[model samples]
Target: METDVLVVGAGPTGLALGIDLARRGVAALVVERAEALFPGSRGKGLQPRTMEVFDDLGVLDAIRTAGGLYPVGMLWQDGRRTGEYRMFDAVEPSEDAPYTEPWMVPQWRTQQILRARLEELGGKVAFGREVVGLDQDEGGVRARFASGEVVTARYAVAADGGRSTVRRLLGIGMTGEAVDPYPTLVADVRISGLDRDNWHIFPPGGAGDDYLAICPLPGTEDFQLVARFPEATAPDLSLEGVRKVVAARSHLAPESVTELRWASDFRPRAALADRFRSGRVFLAGDAAHVHSPAGGQGLNTSVQDAYNLGWKLGAVLRDGADAALLGSYDEERRPVAADMLGLSTRVHRGETRRGEATRQLGLGYRDSPLTRETRTHPGPLRAGDRAPDARVAGIRLFDAFRGPHWTLLALGDVEAPEPDGRTRLVRGPAPGTYGPGLYLVRPDGYVGWAGDTPAGLPDYLARFGRR
Candidate 1:
């Protein structure tokens, strides 16, 4: 087989990249080792930024229909009832920024939606094609599969899971340490006497040397129970072992839980790849970084990584930009993954002192060259930052930003008018009605350049708009 881009692994990251490339009229192929889609609920929460990307992919509605909207407020450790730290309270959405509510959907359902979208775009994932080996040249990459099939592509992306064969073949080192030896079992089960609306966190006091978390599954009364057991006494994560842990943590009788949908034992670790790219091959998702699923950032971070790199790859393939443009993938996304690794490490250590500021507010890239031209306060989230989503005018604008066109959000009638051709100007009430800013949005929905006035338009177009 031959293609423009060969994406390994059919997880959220690879699927997202494939969809974006196909939408850009790029021919891409995705290969997965598994024979079919994996079932069960994993990574049960989508952050606000991730929801925005989903909206741009034009599948947030399907995700919402399959999953459900879950607005999770912060939980206090001492049993004090504090006010909700809603994501909407931090970043207000506008006509350009849509996708208000964060979603709570299983990873499988999310992949199903992405698969449907990719199929519609004339790209399909080839399952049961395990990449056994690969060889790369100055021009392209050739991959060998276990089933005696070989494929070549101009570039190959390794979105494979933590134990990525591509990463190993390329000899990329993963640098980080593992969390202290503690056994944790995550199970999807149906419990008769539990509230499904709230996430019940039982710290390590009342329960028998275990910490418990109960999260609701959409469209069903069942809950996903995550329990951390003492390393000394925790049994292997068998069906009976999962039932015993759930019963012990929830303080309910063993018979109260009827069916165990899925159960797995995962040890949390924090590691980042030494490098993200080599020659014509690149890495994203778990192949790039792996951390504890503390804040549920694994899938979301991987998906966003794909979003950040997909457009750049398409531009490089079609427009023949500097190969250096692809280098920005690591430079931009590595820090974000590093920060997530630090945050996940802290969460694993039971450090929850940092409030919403640390969790929601401390994520932005204001220093990148792409964002430096924007005039805004220097903080995690600024003018050039990935704008958060909120409810604006009752229509989700994030969905509107998904297409392959430059978005000019005319906030407050600035001195500069919209550029003619190849740009979509979304005009709304000027001044504070639209957050008192003008954004030159890239096709992928990231803030390419933003300013209070339109003075930065020329530089913005010169930097990202043209070849």
Candidate 2:
């Protein structure tokens, strides 16, 4: 088989990338070793910035429909409710930032939505294709599957989780530390006595005992159960084992856990790939960095990785941009991944709270080579900052930024370059988030260049093949 890009592992990262490439008319295929989609409620929180990415990917409405906001956390003592508190710091939605809180959706459901969108855009995924060997040359990549079939593509991405086969085949090394000495068991199960309105938490009964948490998954009847065990001890994944742990940790009976749908155990660890790129292959998601799940940054960061790489791949493969433009993917995302890794580790260790930082709206590529800040005195939103959403000239800014295209916001008499095949212009009065200036918004929704006029905009656009 031959394709423009070969995406390894049909997890959220691979599927999201496939969707982005497909919408841009790039030929790509997502291949997964598993026979079907992942079935679990893990990685359930969608941070606010990720919601914005979903909006642009044309899956926000379906995501919102399939999921709901997180419930207030309810503490329990001796089977009686003690208190309730919000999980994240409360932030109200404003005109500039519409999504303030994280949304909750099972990881499985999220992948399903992304895959559907990919297919809607004429993309395809091949299941049970295990890439056993990968060979890359100056021109392209050649991959051999375990099934004795071979496929070739210009590029390949490793979204195959932490122990990525692709990353191993490329001999890339990972650096990290175990965040916690103990192991955590997370599962999706049906419970008999827990109310779905609150996330039930049971503190450890004794010094040696472990804590248990059962949070209801939105849009489903199952609750996600989490428990910790002593180091070097394997937490049982069997139904009886889950029941025993729940009964011992909480005040519930063994039978309260009616059914266990899926379960896995892992030691909380933090790791980052030494390099996100090797030859024609690039690593993304868990393959690039693995985070402790405390801040809910792992999956959100992974999806955004796809968002960042998608446009660069499209520009080079479809829009005739220079291949050197692809180098920015590693230069831009690796640092962000490292920062998120630290944030997740801090949140996991209880050294930090899930406040503004956990929302990830503050992440950007301010120091990236692609960002050009030309204004003498730029406003709060500068080059490489996320262009906030606002109502400008009777049209919503996000509405203007949607789709696979660059957006030029010519606010308050800043003349916009004539609209071209790949760029859209939004002319309006200056909104407070962005003081009057010419903002060149990248397809991924960051301010690529800002100037008082369109003085250097043409050169910057030309670098991205915006003719």
Candidate 3:
């Protein structure tokens, strides 16, 4: 095999997985159809959970430097305000919860950062090499590229976009209904005389009945304007069309807009693949699920998908762990995708706007066996929960709320157990401050089990560790 893992698509999901695999000394090769990284800002926001994953990759600082932080609040159809809700305000980080704020960065910039990190880890994305065809077998998979190149790998991850070539080759059906009233324009422009502090200027009935979402882009005078139009009323991508929409919706003159960087029409749709993995070939990101970009969860979920699968793939390839470990990827992530699909549908239907809990606190996995066995009540965040970030011992880091690895947090006078070379124990000030219990964090940064006894630690490790 040319590589241990072959990833199709150089977007966030594929790049993230490639970086993690490379960090773990796995031979990962990534391919992208585009000749150059996408320059346009597609998905321009990162959720709090995604930021935590970035922190774990040691690229959070770089992402922070490249991005801007904005406190998000909701604006109702009636024009009532729901005061700004900071991403970290609800869930305080402890030794358990780590990330605090959801950083808003353009998708293009985020991809650049991930690509740079992947290079630092000694892997590079093969751009313009699209996957034309792929065939999988019991031991390995063979992939053919558009550039007349072919390679084989022990496994392949299809991080490709919604219309995945790999998914088609695998004969996997995407089961879902299309959202009608198609064709909405998402344009990013530099407009004057608009309040930059707030988002969403709804016209009576919210997004469904002519509402506009104004997203402030840091370091630039531009803002992303996501406007949904009735299918029959949708206009062409022209200056006159833009002017017409803005005038009809906001009573603002089109001439006030100086520069229009990108303006394109897109339809809102939701879908989920019938399967996530087919033998050794797996589908992730948009390949597994897709939804409207209303809540900005597309890129975030894609990156998280990579984070969940990367370490598992690395461990399995390097440590010779059971193949069952890979099954957990589909088990854990599919539900999150389903939930996001539902959330995006609601957002598209204008049922609600993005809330604080939706942004930070509400996402978790209580169904996982790992969380069910060890947790009495959901820890700061539960399994399948979006991990929270908090300050601990004056050190700021992404907290481990998802279950995978054992996080030995030494609080107070309690000395940390001697290094077992496997567990990651974070020593903090004040003993017994972690609520009289020790935490065992999973690889995805959730608490798998917690207790004061040494027996709990061994059992937790034995359950998740390579047998």
Candidate 4:
């Protein structure tokens, strides 16, 4: 195999997977059809859970610098401010959840940051290499590119977005519905006569008029504009067209629309592939599941998919784990994607608000076959739940958990395991979230197994080919 893993599409999912594999010393390749990284602001909102994921991936500091908090929504009518619209329920930061809110970074900037980090780790993305077809044998998978090149890898992943070429070639069917039939235009533009303090909202002027929104893209001189049109009406993509929409929908003049950086139209939809895996290949991100932009779940869920699969792929390729360990990826992630699809649809149709659930901190893998709850009685942070970050005796839990190793947090004399370089062992007093027990945090920051003693710990470690 030319590489251990072949990641298609250099969006957030593929870049994140590349970064994880590079850190684990796995030889991998990332290919993108586009000439450069995605130059759009489609998936701009990053949830608190994803912030934690980035923290572990070593990009949180740069991500924090590249974005700002989501501003409060401002309502307008007749060129006057009517009231304030809360885009998201505000939450305060705590010791367990330091990143309480979603950070607004343009998707383009996020991809650039991930690409830079990948290169820093000696991994690079080959742009303009489009995979046209793929075939896999017992040894490995071969991806045929449009440039008449065949790239082989032990395994391949499809992160090539919703209309994934890999998925289509593999004949995976996506079952979903159109969340909104109305055509919507999302664009990145530069406009004046608007304060950057709030996300400006222009409500429907007449009975059949459409609503428009202009949000100042943080850390840049761009404003993301979204306008909803009636059914069967196609949005105009020209600069004059965007200026007309701004003038008609808002109080700003046509010329106030200084620059139309990028614009695209789509009908909001929710979809999930029939299967997350096919032989030597697996699907991820938009290829596995497509979500509505409402509630900001699509991109966050996509990144989490990478976070879940990265470690498993690393275990099998670099750690000599059984290939059966890879089966859990489909089992664990498919259900989560199905649930998030519902959540995104609910948030899109106004059936639900962007509440705590949207933050994704409560998501877990309790039913996953890999999760083990050996303890008779469990605390609030149990097996299959997200391991809450805490500070025990001046040692930050997240700081200790920030690496490509399994962490065994043995609290209060739980017969700590023998030292091993593969898994880091640490002992401390149990915090409030975790009562008194042994907590095993997975590399992806989830509590994989919990017990009162180290009775079944060795077997569990051996199952994943860990020492």
Candidate 5:
């Protein structure tokens, strides 16, 4: 089989990338080694920025319907309620940032929604196609599957998890440190005595005692159980083992855990791949970076990785853009991944709180080579910053920025370039969110270039093959 791009792994990253490419009319295929989608609710927190990405990918409504807000933590001592513990700092939604808090959706459900959207846009996912061999040349990439099938594509992305076979085959190295020495067990199960309104917390009673947390999963009857064990001790993943841990840690009896839906074990470790690109192949998601699940940054950062690369790939394949545009993927995302890894480790060690930084709305590409800021003195909103949402001249900025097209906001008579096949020009009065200027928003919704006048704008557009 031949395709424009071959995406490995059907996790959130690959599925979201498929949706982005499909909307751009790029022919791409997502291949997964597993027979079906992931079944666990391990990465359940959808940070506010990811919600915006889902909105542009046309899955926000379904996501909102499938999940609910996180509840306050209810502390239990000796089987009696002690006091309420707030998990996150409360923040209200504003026009600039619509999603203020993280939404609770199971990772499995999130992947399902993304897959359905990909299919709706005429994309396909080939299951059980484990890649055993990969060879790339100046033109395209040829991959060999375990079933002896050969597929070639112009580019390939390794979105497979941390133990990525593709990254290993490419001989890429990862630099990281163990966030914690203790092993953790995470599972989805049905419990008998816990209320679904609050996240139940069981603190360690004394020395040598471990803590356990059982949070209710939204849109389902299962509660996610998390427990920590002693250093160098392995976590038991069996049903009986889960029951024993629950009985020992919390006041609940072993018989309270009625059913086990899924279970897994892992040590909290953070690692980042040495690099993100190798010849025609690029690493994304867990393949590029792995985090301690403390700040709920693993899945959110992975999805954003796909979002950053999708448009660059689309530009090179579907549009007449320079192949050099793909280089920015590494230049832009590697630093962000490194920063997030540190943040996750800090949050895991209790050195930081999941506050405004965890929201991820502050992330940007201000220093990216693709960002051009030509002005005497830039305002609060400059090139490479996220263009805030606003209503200008009866048109919503996000509504105008949606879809697989570049947007030019000609605010308050600022000189702007004319609309082209791939660029849409929106002229309106300058909203307070963005001062009066010509702001060129990338397809992925970052201010790529900003200027007071149209001078040098044509040259910047030429870099994206937009002339």
Candidate 6:
């Protein structure tokens, strides 16, 4: 058939994009190769910045209801409690940066929430449709699936996980080194006699080859089990095999793990794509970058990728913006993905702690070509910085920035342009937010352009087809 945008893969990335497109009144379609949503507890942590994103997407309430805060880590030795290990550096919330810690929700549960949101916004996923071949020109891209259905769209996005079929079809190459040599087994299993209040870790001793961790998944009856094997060894994924490993490493008996829901083996590696865009096709999520699952950056970064691209796509497709606006997606996201990959590797290798860097609240496109900083000297919040949360004149900055529209904050006598329906004008006193400047906030909650006056504001608005 035909659509404005074709989103391949129904994982968190594609579903989030579909929701964004749907709310923008764009005709988008999402296709998935699997018969149902992903069933696993992988990618279980949502970073703080991602929590803000979820808040904007209208899923934060459901997500918070379905998940809980990560519990403290309980170290175990010889079947006895030894000491407590804090998994992340403690940080209090601030008026500028909220969501100080990551939230715990199984990846499957997170996907379910996103899918429900997509459906609520008038979008649906086409399952059991595997994309076998793809061809794109200057106008649009055509996708042929295994079911003999050919679909055409103005643009296409690849969010089909690390082993992305679309990336392989486009001949995109991923380059990076293996982060760890030990094989890892991750599974969701039902267990007994373990308190659900803390994450239990059995460190490797002289007798054991490696370590095993059992983390109780919030809002579920299962605990996620992660075990490491010796170098060059392939860990078994069978139920009996996991039972043996758990009994050997932890204090719990084999029968304690009563049911095994899902399990998989993987080698932790970090890799980034050679390019995020190829002609009319774009890469997102694991299709573009692969992380070590440390610092919980992979899934969060993937969702942000969709968040970054969604508004641009809406602008070009529906708002009469220039096609060149799309180029900023790669210019802005690639470097952030590279930095996150490095951060995940460092966290995995014990070279760093889960401190401020892992929070990802500071990531921005300051160097992107789209960011225009026109001022004698900018203050703390400049062009390309994340628009911090604040309340000015009874108007919450985020509330004004919500939905698919840009916000121009005329703070403290800064001359601002008259906002129309598409552009929201929020005038307020300086809560010391931007130090008396006109801040142009993008739909994605980034400071796109900032100036002391409305001198170059018209030109900036014209770039996005805004009047």
Better of 1 and 6 by TM-score: 6
Q: Pick the winner on TM-score between candidates 1 and 3.
A: 1
Q: Give per-model TM-scores.
A: 0.85, 0.99, 0.83, 0.99, 0.99, 0.99
Error of 5 at 118 (Å): 0.7
Encode model 4's per-residue lDDT on 272-386: one tens digit a residue.
9999999989999999999989869999999999999999999998888999999999999999999999999999999999989999999999999889999888777889999
RMSD of each: 4.5, 0.8, 4.6, 0.9, 0.9, 1.0
Q: Which structure is stronger by lDDT: 2 or 3? A: 2
The residue-by-residue lDDT of candidate 1 on 286-362, one tens digit each, is 99999787656778789888988898887777755566778778888888888877876786676753334233323
* lDDT of candidate model 2 versus the reference: 0.93
Cα miss at 260, model 4 (Å)? 0.6
**TM-score, candidate number 1:** 0.85
Candidate 4 C-alpha error for residue 199, in Å = 0.3
Q: Model 2: per-residue lDDT, tens digit, 1-467?
A: 99999999999999999999999999998999999988998999999999999999999999999999899999998988999868887789999899999999999999999999999999988999999999999999999999999999999999999999999999999999999989999999999988899999998887678889999998889999999988877999999999999988888999999999999999989999999999889999999999999989999999999999999999999888999998999999999999999999998999988989889999999999999999888878999999999988999999999999999899987767787889898898999899899998999999999999788888888888775
Query: On a 0 to 1 TM-score scale, where does candidate 4 land against the true structure?
Result: 0.99
Error of 4 at 313 (Å): 0.6
Off by over 4 Å in 3: 69-101, 179-182, 192-209, 247-252, 360-362, 369-406, 410-417, 427-434, 456-467
lDDT of 4 at 376: 89
Q: Please, what are the lDDT tens digits per residue for candidate 5 over residues 27-134?
A: 999999999999999999999999999989999999999999999999998999999988898899888888989999999999999999999999989999999999
Residue 442 accuracy (lDDT) in model 1:
71
lDDT for 27 in candidate 4 is 94
Give the better candidate number (1 or 3) by lDDT.
Answer: 1
